[model samples]
Structures are given as structure tokens and as C-alpha cells.
Target: MAVVKISERGSFRKEYIRWWKHPEKDIQLFDWLDENERERKTLFSPGYLRDRRNPLPYGLTKMECGLRAAAALFAGDPQRGQDYAANPRRFSMSVHDHIRSLRFKYRRFNSKIGAKVSNMAYVDIQGPLLQKIDQLMLVECPEWIRLHFHWRTDPYYNQYWPKDQPTAREKPVQANAPERQLRKSSPGLVNQKRALQASAVRVRDGQNKANSPVMELPTPRENSNSGTTQVRSSSTTQEIETLASEGGHASVIHGGATNLDGSITSIQRLELLIQLRKLDIEREDKKYAAELQRAQVEAANRHQSEKHEIMKQLADYVTGGKGSTGGSSTGRDE
Candidate 1:
């Protein structure tokens, strides 16, 4: 009785097969299969619930959508949603071919095949038909591929483009086309610029703090000459020690120790740091600008060149262009 979503179709198949294979879970599997059967029949039969979320594309008819849904169910294998998303025209045509094959088989031989196996089950006046329905369903399971079906035999072969691999026409287009620059978009450039600006602002703020004045009080002098000279000498030594310590710290930032002559002041050293950071920001901006330019150029070439024309042609062909001779193949499988 579990309600299966469209995306979970493949997963349900896997679970169903796994549980059905186990002899111990026969009762559970049968009950689950019956629920699934009733659900599929109700959904695919006339007057099924219309799902707006998975609505059909602009050009596709309701019948086409229903047909594709049935094809997906009978497909019996995982059909990737990505394939349909990439190109619905190609996906629908493939589904059409599958349904055509199934319809042909249903009309030509399935009735007789079903009749041969009908005697295995008991029938009641008010119950289901006396047939091995489960076994019959297994016999009609669809294959993922048709090994012998060639494009030349198909009337609408030109419209059938492979999603997994590029065609001969597309190869040259791709080779000539420039590579996509995923990281070089406008948003990335703007983000880098903002970050660089913030860094520059921080560097400027640090420089301003380095230039701020610091108030100092003269060391207290002794009343006697001898004491005064001693105090003066001590104060000079302490000042020299403090300047040396400050210079040592500045050396780490400036890439070299301050000169003995004290040519570079703290303010000048901070200015140098600010200038270096500005240069780094400018360099980054130029690099990002160049990358963005290249990305724009690549986009223009891809959309305005021969590649665009080829894509348009393929799309028109798939949708059945006006006065177009190309149509579905009339031939049948042997």
C-alpha cells in the first residue's frame, strides 16, 4: 500500500525484485505487488489524477505524456530523469518507439500467449479471471536497449540525438568551442572585489593607528648633580632599549631589521605595508577581470556561431518542423 513517487520508481523496482526473490517473503510480496498493481492501473487508466508538479512541456500533448509514463513503467529498468530533463524531445521519441513495439506485440501474440497459461488458476463468477497474471506480467517486461535497431531504418533518425555521447557533427563544434570558465562569473568577480576592498580598508585602519601619537612624561630627576646625571643616563639607556625592541618587532613586518641609523619610522613602515597590500588587491582585480572577459567571449562564441545553428536544427527536427520531410520510420522489427 506504499505510495511510490515518480523519482522512486527505480528504487521500488529494486526492492520489489529483491523481496520477490526470497521464498520466505512470498505472502508479503504478493500483497505488496497487488497494491502496486491496483495503483499503477488506476494511475494509467482513463481519468487519472493530473500532477501539476511534473507537468508536460509546452509542445507535448497529454496523450504523449501519458504514453511516456506508460513506457517508463513498462521499461522495467531505471530511466534517468536527467536524460529527459536535458532533452525532452529526444526522450519522448524514444518512448514512442518503445510503446509502438509493445503495442505491436500485444496485438500480434500476447493474447494467445496469455490464453495458453490461463488454465493454471481457479475462476469464480464474481472474482478475477482464471489466469497466471503475475507470470504474464513478467513475460511482457521491457528491455533497456534494442541491440539490432539501427538509425538508418528509422524515418526520424535525424531527430534522434544521443545524450551520453556527442555526434560527429557535434564533435567539431565542441572542439572549436572554447572551454567554459565556471569560476569566472560576474558574482565571483564582485565577491573578490568586495573582499579585496575590505582587506585594503583594514590595512588603512592599521596604518592610522600606527601613526597615532603616544604621550610620554620626563623621568623624575634627583636634586643633586651626580644623582641627576645618573638618572639622565639611566633614562637614555631605557629609551634606547624601548626603541630597539619596537624596531625588532617592526623588522618582522617590514621583511628586514630596522637600520641602526633609524632611517625608517614606524609610520613610514606602516605606509609601506599599506602600499604593498594595495598592489596585491590591484593584481587580483586584474586577474579576475581577465578571467571574466574570457568567459564572456566564450559564451558569445558558443551561442552565436555554427554550434547554435546545429542545435536549432536538431530542435526543429525533433519537434516536426513545417514542410519537413523527416518523420518516424514505417518499418517494423523482424
Candidate 2:
């Protein structure tokens, strides 16, 4: 067997009729109905809903009943309908009061209600007002209302208005193609390049001077041929010799010899002494050869004396004398 699932339809129409006839089905409904009836009588009169006081049944069609119910729900109390018909401010004040009450009740709890309350409060009145305004604009006055009412005055209303007008500040215009190239070749850029080159040239010239060789006193060639390799003077050479004999051992030598004349003399003196060292080594080798020969001759004489003494002892032993047997010997007559 195939079972069909079905849902019972909820009749907003029936709900509306029930609320209208009884006006006390739900506690919220009862309170709202009593409050609405009080407000309606205060704004209108007790006879407002009745056709006659004596006999005729107070008749209302289903559509009227629905409309009244909807108006009461939107206004937040039934009495607000009478106030709305009387004056728009009364209806607006009622809406504000209802929103304030909802906000207060929802704010008491620290739960999800706090977040929903603001939106619920806003929509409760704002939704109906917007719908009514839209209906009026569409059916009643389209152009007149648009021209007179600056809908943008209200932040909420401006959101729904047509967006055609331009904003106050427009975007800047981009430079034309030729203008861009012109900017690159401007005189200002040309001057900047020239300034940079001049600064670089000055820097290069300064560094070159720092590394250049300094001039010194003239040598023998400068005085004689004026072109050949310059030989230092005798006095300068003597000063160089003195500095070289000092053995490059002094830390202050460089400080004292910074002058161009002193530096040249010191360098030449060092070179001459190195040459003298090579010559001195060869001379010492030649000088020590005769002493070495004398020492070798003296060593050979000592060795010969030792060998003669050993031979004499052997001769004595072979002759079988008492001397051979280790006794002292005296001289004998031939």
C-alpha cells in the first residue's frame, strides 16, 4: 500500500476571523485587542464599529475583517487604526512606542533575542510604512511625490530610491599620451642629469689627487744629463744608509719619512743594504777555509801518537818479557 503524506493548511483567514470575533484566543491577542479597542474609542468613538445602536446586526465582510486585523498587527495595537486615520503623527508615535516596548523586553534577556529585537522592531513599523508609501506612489502620485519628497532625507528611504545622480567628487582625468612623453623630456629632468654628472666629475678628481705620486728632490741625472735615471746625491745616500742600518725596526720611521725627499732616500738605502748582505755571505765562506785546515792537521798528529804507543806494547808482549806480562820495565844496557 502506497501511503500519501499530507500537511494541514494553516488558514490566515480563519485565524483573522477568530481573532476578530473573539479577540481573546491568545493572551497576546487578548491584550492587544483590549489595548486596540481602548485606543480606537479614545481616537474615534464607541459607535465607530456599529451601524445602529437598536436592532441591525453589526456586519463585516471577510475582506474587511482581514484588513482590520492586518492594520492592527502592523500598528501593533488595533486602536492605532483610528489614530492613523485621525492623524499620521499619532500612528508614527504609536509605532515608536511599540518599538520601544519590544526593545525593552528583548534587552532584558542575554540571549538570541537581543540580536533579533532591533531588526524585528525596525521591520514591524518600517515594513508596513514602506509598503504603504510604495502603493501610494504607484497608484496615487508618482511624479509629484518624487519631486517634493527628498526620499534620501531618510537613510532607510534612500536605499530604495533610483540611483541616477552622480556623486560630488568625480575621478581625475588621465594624462593624454603626448603629455606623458613631454613630461619625461622636460627641462627639469635634463638639469638633474647634468647636476649629477658634475658632482661625479668632482668626486673622481678628488680621488685621483689622493692617489697621485708626490714630487721629490732632484738626483745626479737631474743635475747632469737632466733626462737619464736620477742618482741620489751623496748626502741623501748617506742619510738612506743610516736609516737602513737601523733595520726597519722603528714604528715611527714612516711618520718621520713622509716627506717626498726622505721617502726616496730611505727606499734607495734599503735596496743597497740588501745587495751588501749577499756579498758579505760570499766573503765569510772564503775567510773561514784556512782555520778549518789547521784544525784538521792537529787532529791527524794526535791520532799518530796513539797508534805508536799501541805498537810498542804489542812488541813487548811478543818478546815474552816481564813488560808483556804487565810488570814495570827499567832501561837496560845494549
Highest lDDT scorer: 1
Error of 2 at 281 (Å): 2.2
Task: For residues 247-278, write the lDDT of model 1, one tens digit per residue.
Answer: 31211122122334754322222223333344
Best by TM-score: 1
218-243: candidate 2 lDDT, tens digit per residue: 11122456333123233333433343
Where is model 2 more than 4 Å wrong at Cα? 1-268, 287-291, 319-334
Q: Measured by TM-score, how close is model 1 to the native structure?
A: 0.19
Q: What's the TM-score of each model vs. the native?
A: 0.19, 0.16
Residue range with the least summed lDDT across 10 consecutive positions in model 2: 13-22
Candidate 2's error at 233, in angstroms? 30
